[model samples]
Target: MTKNKAVFIDRDGVINEVLTKRVKFVNKPNDLFYLDKVPEAIGLLSSADYLIFVVTNQGGVGLGYMTEEQLEKIHKKMKIDLESEGGEIQDIASCIHKPNEGCSCRKPEAGMILKLAEQYKIDIDKSYMIGDRDVDIEAGRKAGCSTIFIGKEDNTVDANFSFPTLYAAANWLKSTSNL
Candidate 1:
């Protein structure tokens, strides 16, 4: 089978506003909010024939801060909202294990990416990972995918590109891909 191409995205700071220092999980569906220009950004990427997948580390679930059912509700609502804006998510893979647990599915480990690649038959060489943190870039690099760091500060990772926001990353992808 032909390998698929994908864009792996991080959830918290990349998709929604980051509530730093807050111990809250987006436990409820109503708590989900897209960052400014996020909808349009996602719309642009969706139009480019890229399979959009979210690879997030939600350790709060394992820490007992939130329930799995609650997370499901939030994700369902998120998918609905994004689809309403002409954005589509092919799948969402999450690492619910805590950092101390030494699980392989977390960011910087490339476990989730590897699993997704196997499941979707994805071509890692043609894949891109976009997020707002160094861990995101590290994971992408470990998985042999191009990395795009979306943040004002330099991530210091050998990322393929950097953008101030998801919208900027989307624009870059659109122009670079000529889509």
Candidate 2:
């Protein structure tokens, strides 16, 4: 089987709006808010034959701020919304451990990506990871994938490219693919 190329996306701040009020995390489907251009951006990448996946850290779950059931509800809603707009998510993975838990699947670690690669037979070198934080970039780098950092967030390390939004990154990928 040919190895598949994927576009791994960070959940919060990239797909949904980042929540800052609770200090916990997005604990419900009601808290999930899709960005304006997210569906289009994801669709554009999907059209280019990239399998889209989501890799997120939900420390809130481990901290008792959110339940795994709640997280699943939010993901189900997100997938429905994205699919409605002609986008598809092949898989979703979350690291539901706090920083003190020493989990290997969290951002800045390669556990999640490595698991996905093993499960899907993905080509890590050809895949790309897009997110809005330094941890995301670090994870991508550790996973041997190209990285795109979204938003004007302070990512003073390890990102292959930085753009203002996912749309911009998608445009860059689209343009580069034609070359």
* TM-score, prediction 1: 0.93
State the lDDT of candidate 1 residue by residue for 36-79, as single tens digits. 78878878888876788999998889999788998898888877
Candidate 1: pairs in clash: none
lDDT (C-alpha, whole model) for all candidates: 0.85, 0.86
Best candidate, lDDT-wise?
A: 2
- Model 2 segments more than 4 A misplaced: 20-24, 153-155
lDDT of 2 by residue, 69-175 (tens): 99999999888888776778999999999877888899889899889988999999889999888899889999999999888756475588888888888878877
